[model samples]
Target: MSANQLNYSVSNAGAFSDFASVTEGMLKGKIFLKDGLQLTSMEVSLNHLPPKGEVPFYHKHQQNEELYIFLQGQGRIQVDGNEVDVHEGTSIRIAPDGVRALRNTSATQGLHFIVIQAKENSLTQWVETDGIILDQPVEWITRSSCLK
Candidate 1:
């Protein structure tokens, strides 16, 4: 019988830990690549607004499917001209060419969730948000909640 070859290391504690200071303001992601692990699963632990909090641009996928699993916190989901409220323990699936965006309405509390890009050669698309002017850079979540 032949044997397979595989080796890896513990990445930033190997598993999930208390994301207090690590995930402060914008969205922070820790890649497990340098840790020497295969890309078995596509996962991201999102804390805070993840760079562009309230004003997330609306865009579509070129060739990938995405899903946002709300581990904790609350937010609203806008898809294909429809808006859906998302909360903890909720998994929202988005398809290609589908319009999508999320906004955090909490005051002090932040939204914690895992982004699962279930498609290969596909990346998160936020090129043209719904109401965003597309020329000006979004400062921060100036609005209380999502418009659409």
Candidate 2:
């Protein structure tokens, strides 16, 4: 599908240049902003790190907290001097002021991850309170099943 569709956008991480090509102190991923995603409250990026590579510097944000989700390979993330091992399915959340750095520890596999950033303490509602049940039936579900 095209990067920007009806109400959403989709793009692969591989579409962006390698992390090694990113300049120092810059975000090391394909930010959705450049894809015309029209995001207003948060920023998302798809990141890939070469095997045995590491972010050259530790950094922190001033107002945006970050969540890192590891999707492939092995890695280590350091936050405020504490290190944690991460691999596929691993996730870590860091507050705005928490200094953080990452490294790809695998000898032969690249690290694939996603980073989501948003203003801290900005969420006022969660799934239970924010979502409303709709009476409309889903197209994928059989009509007879709705009666059950």
Candidate 3:
């Protein structure tokens, strides 16, 4: 890796180059780079969203902290149970286990947001806070297990 800076203006990654097809990802950019940045230092990558782009099924993480900075188009963000508007210049974050989702709401434009996931094990650790279980089937399974 060369002793290079991550300033996109200086990097050769062409515009509309880092296309992230999936609904959501922790990072989106050229897979290999010369930054050699560390987790403590953190890194940034640009992202793309197709029309009607929606993030992965709502879920939470065990230890990861994430942030989304909207750079283009219009959209909506649902966090925990609150839905809010999103658009260029909107900044959002999901603390460790916060339930959140992003949805593109524009008709003629595609949504784009820069996402950064902080250093985390990325282990989907599941635990019911306040004995809450949203999945009724799973709740039933657990109750049956204890009775058996």
Candidate 4:
């Protein structure tokens, strides 16, 4: 396939939403053109949670690393069993083996965040977040079968 066939983009405002209920709470999610774009080794989405909503499970990836950038309201992210506060402007990076989950703690506003997942050991650079970069490679062993 041509490279042009592999490249596609969508605006958040134009994306369609999907809903899921998990142990944490109700999730209103908008996937970033996964089917249409035919992405490989990467995934992106926007998640919005009402007050007191949360992701039900602590999940880990064996081949993919994840990054979450908080966009609105407030929430708590549990990473490796530790709960950390997150709000607008907060960014988090989770390696493939790190167990992670999220909860929306905001009472009046929704908790909105952008999630990006890429293959483990991939080079990632952020213009913001102090120009953060990740370049180290890791050989991750799966804890169990992935349910993703």
Q: Score each candidate by Cα lDDT.
A: 0.57, 0.79, 0.62, 0.71
Off by over 4 Å in 4: 1-7, 11-27, 30-32, 124-148
Better of 1 and 4 by TM-score: 4
- What total of clashing residue pairs does each candidate reach? 4, 0, 0, 2
Top candidate when judged by TM-score against the true structure: 2
Which candidate has the top score in lDDT?
2
**In model 1, what lDDT does residue 127 have?**
56
Cα RMSDs, all models: 19.1, 6.1, 19.5, 13.2
On a 0 to 100 scale, what is the lDDT of residue 75 in model 4?
91
lDDT by residue for model 3 (24-139), tens:
23533223222443334344555665677676678776766777788888999888889989898999877876898778787677777666766555534446533564655543
TM-score for each predicted model, relative to the true structure = 0.55, 0.78, 0.57, 0.66
Ordered from best to worst TM-score, the candidate numbers read 2, 4, 3, 1
For candidate 3, the 10 contiguous residues with the lowest summed lDDT are: 27-36
Question: Where is the poorest 10-residue window by lDDT in model 2?
Answer: 23-32
Which residue pairs clash within candidate 1? 27-50, 27-51, 57-129, 58-129
Q: Give lDDT tens digits, candidate 4, residues 1-148.
A: 1123224533333322222332122344544535445666678766777778787878899898888998887999998889999999999999999999889887777777788999877656556744656798877767685222
What TM-score does structure 3 among the candidates reach?
0.57
- For candidate 1, the C-alpha RMSD (Å) to the true structure equals 19.1
Q: Residue 40 of model 3: what lDDT?
A: 43
lDDT of 2 at 101: 93
